[model samples]
Target: MICCLSSLSTCVANLELKVKKNIIFRSGSNDLFKPIAGFSILLLTAWSMQILSIRFSQLLFIFFVLFALWPVARKAWRKSLEGNIFSMETLMSFASLGALMINAVHEAAVVLWLFHIGESLEHYATQRARAGVSSLMAIMPETVMLLDDGILRAVPVSQLKPGDEIEIAPGGRLPADAILQDSMAAFDESALTGESLPVEYAKGQQIYAGSVIVDRVCRFIVTSEQGCNAIDRILKLIDEADAHKSPTERFIDVFSRTYTPIIALLSMMVMIIPPFFYDQPWDMWFYRGLAVMLIGCPCALVISVPAAITSGLAAAARRGILIKGGAALEKLAEIKVIAMDKTGTLTEGRPTVVCVITDKPDDEDRVLSLAAGVEEGSSHPLAQAIIRQARKRFNDYPIAGNRQALSGQGVKGDIDGRDVNVMAPTFAPPFAPDSILQGETERLQDAGLTVVVVALENVPLGIIALQDTLRVDAKKTIQALTAMNVDSLMLTGDNPRAAAAIAGQLGMKYQAGLLPRHKVEAVYLQQIAAPTAMVGDGINDAPALRAADIGIAMSGGTDVALETADVALTHDRLAGLPELLHLARRTRTIIGQNVTISIGLKIIFLLTSMLGVTGLWVAILADSGATVVVTFNALRLLRTEKTLPQMILKENS
Candidate 1:
């Protein structure tokens, strides 16, 4: 801005001398309208005259029309006047008014028309760039089905009141925050809670809005209303997110503010003093000053950052990602390490069978079958894995049981008039698992699998090993990050066996058995190594995410992750991570380039003005043009290729 003002002042001074000395070439100073502006007004006038259309090209003329013909021209009245006028506006306003003062109707019309055209183009470009984030409204569902007793009721999600009982059926999204009361319910909480697994809802476990129920029906007691709900609060943060100023943006603003006053004073001297000393005509010098002011307009400077931001956001949108603002984008660019959550972030959040061991030959099939029968009737990942593995080997097998899922340990049922139990050792420390299954246990454990104990009639049957496998892309994604020189680390609430299994597979660092707060320590440590990003789509991931230099929330299950993350992946995708990094780097580049271009142009132009050779019109074009160019360049982010959907509806605000 400072450079812009300086350039404008010098241009104005030199232009005045040129205008005064060349009165014969064009005595009618108003005729110096921009070429396109003049032609457009001519075309408009011809059309208007033919059809008896309204033709008040001047604002002052519009004022007269309001006074004489239309009593209610609020839009016209307000549009003709507003807040601070930009440098381009100043030049356009002056050129048109000076023309009108000299009775050059066409010149005045062309100048104003030209400015309007430029402003319109700039606005459209900006809107197009910002289209991705502006489309967030479509991602949310409208209704949250509530249940009164066992009977179901459909209601607007926004109208859900605290304590209202809501039913989240399979494939339905939870409408509001609630205490989950349905014990058999399994929620794909990545959207709200950030836990990737189909989170098993105990009798009193809490659930939040925007979570999807993957399997089994669950009922919740609504605990929060619209503004207080999970997703809504995050959306509000996006709405109120403050734009953090980059060094370039702040400097430009300050420069622009100071440069205007300095240049205006210089232009005044050029117009008045030259004529007194050199016998130049007053009208000629005055018109030259006006032309100089027009050149010094700073439209480009105004448009630069917004345009860049628009493009950056658009690019992210095309890849199914979202960043709330320029500041967020900037922060995302700085992440050197990423602390990932274990349960839902790295793994699919579903446990799968990795080992099976039995003392007797038939025991393998028999024990797994009994376990599957009870597990099939339950929602825990361990139970689901037992069923999933059983079906892969033995199909068409009949299962009979009156099942009850034991929250802390396992599921139990009466099968064939006999009691059966499938238990995780962590849940039942007193139940000594069979030593016969020890061989397979070490193999699976060594491979990072969880050993589940199965029993028939209170006697040890066998062990079915389960593990949440790393995402298919997890290894490659880590490799990509490593290649980019970004350190990768994991924070998991799982035991050391589970953490080592996953981390070993990916050749990355891991810390196991971390509680919610302990994960914060991991995030803090990574930040100490370098600027870090805590990447996880989990409710547990939120605090660490907030503490990190950047937070990235995977899109899919829990929105809590999104609320805290600097960047949100609208689509659950690991590929988007790399793409976002690419965009951040690109956005930074464009900002830097624009800043350099704006300053460089101003400096060169200012130098010319000091030599009394620069003109106002040139300064205006250069300043505004730089801004526009920067914006368009930034917008280039919308075209990046590469979108890989890993799948999740997790969130961050």
Candidate 2:
């Protein structure tokens, strides 16, 4: 549609140009080639846009090249295209061709040249914004391990079927939805779950695609096809939402549709108005109207907004932020509240023991040792911390006995022929420690630690302190948000104690013990005050993401959250939000500037066209020039802003 109509307009310009070239000899000796120049560009634009076979498109391209072969026509077109009114490529085309049709050759050429320059700038900006997501889609692995009859073999993932058992090695990516068949498996789900920790999988536990098996080799029974994996689902979300456009794009579309007709109508009035008021030649009025129409190309107004949005996307892509498109970037800029998850967002999601409480003689060390001994062969996070504590205390640790874990309590084992147990405080409190130790337990809990008691052979020894480690940049990020006058709130599924501890540390308001639905409700509540952005990594955070005004999912967040989110950061960085918002707001500003500049120039120039003070050449230049200026202005975003925070290191508070 765009191609066919554009060519028709080109014909109109050429008809006017031809009339002028013959009538006016003083404009230039080189003014004879206007029609060919306008004809070639319009023809190519039309042909390329028409839906056709590759062969036909190529054939049309051949004809375009034939224009180059006819050097004489090319020279005439080039000379005739150079009109004073040219803005961009369109300016040159309009000035030369429209002027020639209206008996003014120089103006049409300038418009044509200006249009091309704008197009070129807009294309560069679009490429940059599309870089990140395209790069991610490129990393999809093509092959996988196929298991059959207990024998493992390499095969294309597509060849595998459900019930096939694939042996996954440490550090290998999970290729399909499957259930773990191994005794123990540890998975790094950062890419899929956004949790910055390796999740331990037991037999019968479900595993998902895009999750890397970090340690302990395991076998999984494939239950789904390769394309139906979690990662694929996330990509599909971006595809489904592809129709979304930036605010700027919407405005430009509205303006482009109406601007040309309005200008054409006014130009006609310009011609008629002159003859009614004074004695003028019909040729003079007609030529002036043609000049007004020649300068009527809305190239700048049509392309300016998209150029700004594309430039913003491109700039975000360079910063390790994968904003899906111009629309997402624009939405992010309007975010006034950022509701962040306590675990994995503001804090490292990993839980660690940062404190210890001793109530009896060597209480802390003894309890840690017994807990570690019982958990020596376990894979749970708390167990691992105890084991590390044991190693740190003893330096060279003795071999532990066979161990077993009691679900939701603790692990158990034999230590030097003594049966030892390490369980929760409510399970085996005061087994070894005196009653005086009770105060220490309260102290640790009050200080924001989950206390797990370790008892050796039924004797309470000491208490273990476990807390989520926070991200180093969390405080600064919150501070930055505050400075921006945007509220920052921490929301979590964790217990009130843990949530309070984190919120206090960050100095932000907190909402604790929230289910996925509740998170959504909280966002809906915040929305009453202002636009909100919700960021999180867990599947539990998905509903809230969709409910928020703008949902930002960490680059490494769970597949569900990532797919549900409107904006995604590829670097897994929280700090990028501030910059992303900054960029989006600036993009809107640039678009507004482009629109104002384009329309302002036209209004002033349109008057000149009516008075015959500006020829068709200058009119074309003004029209196309606006497009190039806007494109250049939008691209300017790429050179600004540097450095975003890293996602890894430390644990959730």
Candidate 3:
């Protein structure tokens, strides 16, 4: 025993030193490692001394137990003094000390060793998950090119303010959200929006921070100050979201807190009641009680929940799905209904002019130019579509003055000394002699086109029909969701006819003409049927997203939407939605399996200990074995690629 313990001690010491050095070099020195290492060595030394002679073995073994007990003793004592007597440390300290009282020194040593290993594993797993998120923060550039006094000096990003003009060379990242000063440039927005392809931005367009300039050198004026850009806010939101605890974790915490004292009391009863009631030998019953304590140690059950959750979180992060925490992942699995916004969520948010209907064929250019001039100052998707079509037809158009937006209606301005208004048909004033234009507008709306009625002082000019094209993968995504037995619905502020037309194409339900508040109400109504998830990519959907059981935001969504959502599809693809749901369901199933194994094994071992069928070594082995099984089972969640590929293949088929 002395030779074996000495070799183990030397091995442990060398291993500890190597691990400590690696940890310190990677994450700075941790204070807890030193004491654990010191006490571990002390326990080994005391055990070695005991093995030298039988005469001194008993006394030295007691000393060995005390040396090993010090750290747990201090922790349990401090927690007890602070009114936290029901902690796992308290349970462990009592259990190990009880083992020593029964003269099972080896069992006590093994118990403490296994407990320490479990703690280390839990801590390391958590740190690894956090490191995955911290890597995103590392992408931010420290300095940026500032065009100060036209000299173009390199300055720290922290010194940048809104309105500052910064020069970005090709292949450089944008340090802040800014308006483009150059005519046009292509950018790789994958870091921010998760869009794999390069996006082109015209002059005066707003580009966010973290976008890489992929084309020629460009200059832009900053719109957001330092520390307030999209990338900075994303990092902050991830930190906040990751801190939330899952339901399973919370239940385990409460269960463990209540479990320790009850088990300790049961061990005490086993020591006292059997000796008195059955006239059993006191030493025999006492040893059995100690074994019972070892068997009932809640180490396996306590560590199981977090191990599985952390593994699931890390796996999801690797796939570009940012589930806020284990709770969000669990909730995602329970979502039976998914309420989605129409624009940006199911379709490309960028609208294009699909048809230009004019009352007179020759006046097409005039009507388009007048509507485009009024919409030039507007940033709405439909407005941009008209402007794009106008630019394609005529390069130079009269500029509009006194431009103003009519909330939920359209834009109004003075173009060529005449009052021009561009709006939806419902928001347009009555036109008595325009039955032909009215008929055309109805026909376009019925075809799912968003018609913009152009009027010159209440006299209709023509109808410019625009439509937000459905995503190529939208039908496939809906079909996949259906195959998973999940219902899909579209909630939009567009006209009911248009909304129904798109929904019919996708073969899903829809609630149209919904304002922001109406969307929230719709989400709440859907939740009555089953657990619901709201997916969107705009500020208007933020409220509805918050109202649902789980909020999934697109990567290209607004910061408010992203911050409010519980899950983010970083790749900005609906294809990831079904994949995320599948992962969440698998994670829940794994957690259930882990909890069952941990608890079931402990119960079986506990019964055997009470019947005197198991001894100290067997009890220790059972406890440690259960922990190892649960941990490995949880780690299986990290290799979810096997399941994900099948899911993708099925979706493709």
Candidate 4:
């Protein structure tokens, strides 16, 4: 009796352990893990019982089939109660239940299991793509050091206001957009601009958020409000861009909505019509109708477009190109004419004093000194260039007083009690009409130099020739665009001679002396022929950028330009433009291929199933196989290098 009692105790212990394991599996936090684990357990139990007893095996099979079908059935029922009955869940539910009715329980279980697995895989891919953008937003620190009352105190970034002084540790990222103060250092701006080189900045220069201080401690005065930093703005743009759907995505959504119900109606007809016309058994046609229903599921077609678009967007973002959305990417592929700004788009935008000509030849230093003193306080690019040159030549100079800025002209001030003016050539003529100076001015203008004339008391002191050099890749970029059959044009407010000179070097057409309004009109004219893209990096280009079909902005561009643009190149280079266009075209091609594969497979399987040439397992293979193929094909966009070889070879040819 004691031995029997000990054996019973062992049996109770094993049962308790089994119950605990079952509870843990059912209560797990992962929604996907629970369904997958339960399905596997039920499938194994059902298959194992088949050798013991046929009756018992059938019961276990039915039990497991229901176990796998519960979630799909619940979802379909909910959708049906809401009067929206043509979802994927509804089709899958009907197919599986029909299979069960025909004693095809094993097939029913395997189909639902495969469908769930596909759903999980697609969800994971989408989440991974979205994580790439989310990682950008996570780079900012939650706390920052505030220099309050000359003392350092740690505070939340949201509490820091504009105009506050902040101290940054050597390796800390900048908390907000700021102006460098009291120090100079090299910064790693790669996170923001994707430029690998460390940029050197001195005191009084603007520093954007997300820049890391690499070498020394720095202090900066904040220039932007809390939550309004450059990174914040970029994140906002990314979010808005992701929310906008492409034309293909919208079409698929509509097609799926209309297609699902039609398939259901067809399946019903296949089940009911054959018995009336032929002498075939009822169960035979019923089974065929079930196979038809399984084959008609629109899983592959519904997921194909979005998967490719999301992958394309993520790939572009990794390469420092911000495509606003799938629609913008689609538009980019169709761009036939590229209207680009002269300064900051094709050229460096930083004009430097390349040549200095003096009437007396010995007074070059004096002419530059006077011009620099007058331009000392101005923030214009040309003014800064003059000041930089003056500091290099003469470290000490007399300060100018009573300074006044002339709109579109240059500046006027009192230097050594003499009225001095430094102006553009359009504002004033050469002080002395000497043939040598006139010839020099013409020569410089022909060479694409912006000649600034300096006059002392209405007499010309000399002319300072400044030039905004073409970007290193400007010619190559133009060639690539031409190879792609995209016509390139330069639109600028500068003189026709200078514009022509620059355009000639790049082999592009030019429309010179364009005001902001004129640039808008030019974009409209270009768009009349074909879709146009406007590339610019200044507030003046905002209107024109908005007018074009696609607007691309340089990363170092003004905030207004960035805000107005539909696409942004994170590095101030045109090399990314070709890659972006390539990606868009490849994405379009993949989407087309996916749609064709999905619809073609469905049509073939539908015909075969109706003719009784395909059975339940074959229908399942068609549905699952098409889904897998389309998904994997769409994922090819994640490796953009694979898409460039053919395009590169074509360009070389």
Candidate 5:
């Protein structure tokens, strides 16, 4: 009988403990739902207090306040156990409980209610700022039209593998990076490139994923495996951006660690010192101290930097400028000198005729027409340049007959029963230094041009000077950078004359004949003078790009350069460089504004609370309201300048 009684008592005690644990967890879960429920009960208690007896009504009010305080207190306790005893929740928990101890039940209820409201607003602002990143997710198509054994079938994008042929319909986005197989089509690449115009692609050209098929149905051979497409790469960058915090954000984080605990200790001193030493009323002094704790919550100060950085990153991505993280963005704004590669960075990577000097000025067009005719069948770079130049001036070119490749010299053929030759300047001149034709040819060569001559029956007609032409936006980009007080320098492996010609045209300095190692050394030397950025578009530039303060690459550049760069201009436009710098500067400005707003409000409320001029309502506002304001201020980056999608939407609307 004794053993049976002891076993029954142990079982009952275990059951009671289990019930208590269940009750505690149930009340603590889903903080928002319970607080809302508790608020409704508090409202009912306030109304019933008018009719009920004083003692019963007082009990009801106290019970309602405790019910609302449970979640806040539980969160504070959990944080304390994790060694974060001075968090914002801890301050709020103590403040509300202090109000309850002082018989300010209504004030306590209002403070918690206001805290919840402020939290909801902060949540909404964060979600809205993230809306731009969410829109990028929608750019990828969930289903793809797979070409299986020449039969079209809809399949999940995840099942796609390299070398699989797929067909995309008009208005459909590509599911993966692919090569155009059969038909040429126009695609809207705004999602990837941020250009509002539709780019036309030829057969065999590579098209990135997320581009919308604008004109017609097209077949493509997938080149990327699942989860390795362009959009996937972008999403991965965003996911990793947080790990690279800016210096400002790191300082704020470190500052908050010591700041929170100091505030907690100071609040304690405020509660005890005045009542004991100054002989003030204990109740009033304690109330003022609770108000001080509420005012000292670092919610606003802690969130200020990251909120701006997150919004700035999303904004930059929308503009087709991929900055690795806040660290890179912050570095970009500090750049005073931008060292840029000449070929493919400031100029087109291919040669084009810049000047046409004919033996007789009137015969320039005639000379070019004959040269284009003779070089029609040649696949040489110089031959293609002549043909491209001729097409720009004359629509119909005279046909050549019996074309012969003059090994190492150039091409020769008969145009309209007359023999014409397009050969290197070494073979087509009068051979006299003083002769007009010879002098002109040497002058063109001295200007870094590849001088090729067109001859009729071995008599020099004219020389066509060719070199890689400057990009259309090169001058505009340089001018914008100059206006912003940033200097530009050209770094290239090309000969001195070629580098000088390009640098002269743009009014910038040049360092020519550099190997990859020399370029890296140049970047290092420039960094000593001021923060410098290196922009390049070739595999040889990868080393220098990695060595700069910030490495920027054109997306159309070699894979090595793109991967090594800290920032990539996806549209491969120089104009985007200035825009990126502007964004960075704006982000820094907003961060400063946010910090000032957050800390300034706290200082005001802290002083007012200690003087007993403000109570819990103003104290909570100083903390939570400041958080909402700074968050919304940081969100301004999303719309500071119109993004590609915003521009497109505005046009349609």
Candidate 6:
């Protein structure tokens, strides 16, 4: 079992030298004192064994065991006082002292040393799991350049409030989430969104905290209050992630609480029952009993799931996939079907004016102007598209008066005292089957363009066709999901023709003309066959997002959508879906491997120790070594991208 063991005295001597040189342990002298002292005692015991009498070496070994047990004994006694008597430290203390009582002095020393090394490895793994949050905290600048009345002054980031303007020097991190005031700015958002290259944001775009200003100096108006920026939210989520434990992690917690005490009781029984009833030698059975206690520490078993879960969460966050917790990450891997909303999830949510047809060629401009007038203040995607088109041809559109939205239809208002209505073709009055308006509506729909009828005094004026382009990676993402044996389904309120057009292009299933509630129903239907995940990025998608087994939202989505979804692709790229899935599946695999390693080793050593095949030193070495192995195995999730080449996010088009 001791395949390789470093010399404890040599390791401690090197550590002491480093401390004296003020290298890594300069600030950790107090922490170094215990290990240095414990190992030095073992060194002295070794030297005494070389020349001194056996009795003298035995006495020195006893002193070493007692000195090693001092720190562990304090912790064990505290927990025993708290009614948790079978804690890891408690078990190890009893096991090492039992070994000494049986005159296994050398085994006792090695057992405690290995136990401490295992604890240190566990501590290091935990710190490494949380390194993401710590590294992110380091990115925020303590001070920012505040701009006031054309004067720039250095001010603490904490002192900056909402609406305060600040200037960012090139290569400096943004202190808080703010809106860019310059015409355009280039920033290195790799620390945040994980894009390798610098991203360009235009004026009025909201730039998150921790983004490095990569180009020229620029100014911004702080939009986030202190501690509510992008980094703060991510940190808070990671902190709360432990509360939302995965089923595997939760089960391990409950199992360990009962399993530890039962193992302790069995170890005591092994020590007493054999010698008292079976007439076994007291020394032999006592040594085997101590071996049982050491083998049953449960350190590796307890840490198996969480170590992997924590590493998985940190890895996902590094790639701009903000999974809320282990529960969400676990569910993500179980997703057999992913139902995506068409508007924002699959296609670019922005629609553009493809063409405007009118009764007369000259009336095309007039009809567009009327439509734009009513949609001027509207935030609807189609309404904005009309406004954008009108702006290109005319200086301004005549303002519509008494504008109103027709539920499930479109908008109606008065334009220059004439009743103007722009509504979906189906909602508009029936047109002559062979009429130009009807023909144009059918032609647009066939081409996957959303057609709206423009009316003046309830008479058809023209039809405008608008279309939202599919995301560059939409087809590729769907293909990737298909290759993984996960099906994709598109749910949209668009007409059957448009939905068919989009779904056909992506080669996926589709459900058209779905309202928010209908989308929820669709999610339910998908769940009948397998676990379903809903991916969307709009207010309408919130209902389905909540109803689905897992909800994933793009970061560019509405606040409600972002809040409703369990996971957020902060980079706003569909390509991240495959990467997220790969990470989740890999995490589940690593967790399984860790659990198998932990439990398998314990079971094997538990049998061997009971038959007196392995002594206390080998038992503790196996248990502590398994703990370190599982931890380092879990840490491998940090490099998952290397295991699966395609799991890395491709540069967004």
Candidate 6: clashing pairs of residues: none
How accurate locally, in lDDT, is each candidate? 0.65, 0.67, 0.79, 0.82, 0.82, 0.84
Cα lDDT for residue 111, model 6? Answer: 85
For model 3, residues 1-653, the per-residue Cα lDDT tens digits are 66765775676556556544543224322643544565466566656665576645555456555655565677679889998886767767777777776667776776676666555554554555455546656877889999988799999989989999899899998888889999889999776544577988899978878789998999999998668776665566556555777899999988877887788889889999978999989988888887777777787888787777777776666566777877898888898999999999998888988887776898889888999889896777788888889888886999799999998898899976889999878998765574578888888888888788889988887888888889877887888888889999999998788798899999999999999999999999989989999999999999999999999998778989988999887657687788778888988898899899989988888899999999866876777777777777777776635554346535575
**Against the hidden reference, what TM-scores do the models get?**
0.68, 0.68, 0.81, 0.87, 0.80, 0.86
lDDT of 5 by residue, 1-653 (tens): 34643553464455335433543233233432443444565557554765856665666567555655666777789999999888888889888888988998767877876776666556556666656665777768888889898799999999999999999889999989899986579999887666788988888888988999999989999998788887777778877886799999999988998998898888999899999999999999899999999989888888889889888888888778888988998888899999999999998786898878865689989999999999997888778888989988998989799999988788899988999988887666364344477777778777877788888987778888889889877877787788788999999998888899889888899999999999999999999999999999999999999999999999879999989999988767787887888889889999999999999998999999999999987898778889988999999998855634234334433
List residue ranges in candidate 6 displaced over 4 A. Answer: 1-49, 52-59, 357-375, 392-437, 453-462, 640-653
lDDT of 6 by residue, 1-653 (tens): 12212354455456546444633222232463455454666656565675846665666567667766766787789899998878998998888777777778888987877777777677678778878665999878999889888898998889999999999889999988899999888999888766778989888888988999998899999988888988888888788787799999989988988999999988988889999999999888888888999999999999889999999888888888889889999988898899999987899888999998876899999999999998889999999999989998999779899999998799999977889999988888777555688877888799788889988898888999999989878987887787788889999998889899899898999999999999999999889999999999999999999999999998889999989989988768787787788889998999999999999999999999999999888999999899999999999888634423253224222
lDDT of 3 at 63: 54
Stretches off by above 4 angstroms in model 4 are 1-34, 81-83, 169-171, 179-208, 406-409, 425-435, 640-653
lDDT of 2: 0.67
- Poorly placed runs, candidate 2 (over 4 Å): 1-98, 121-243, 276-279, 360-365, 376-379, 391-408, 411-419, 431-436, 642-653
Per-residue accuracy of model 4 over 286-320 as CA lDDT, tens digit each: 98898888889898898888888887787777667
Question: Number of clashes in every candidate structure?
Answer: 46, 68, 0, 0, 0, 0
Report the C-alpha displacement of residue 223, candidate 4, in angstroms: 3.9
Candidate 2 per-residue lDDT over residues 195-279, each given as its tens digit:
5668777888677676788977788898777577655655554444345677668867766656655766776676787788786
On a 0 to 100 scale, what is the lDDT of residue 144 in model 6? 87
Rate residue 387 of model 1 by lDDT. 84
**Colliding residue pairs in candidate 4:** none
Candidate with best TM-score: 4
lDDT of 5 at 332: 86
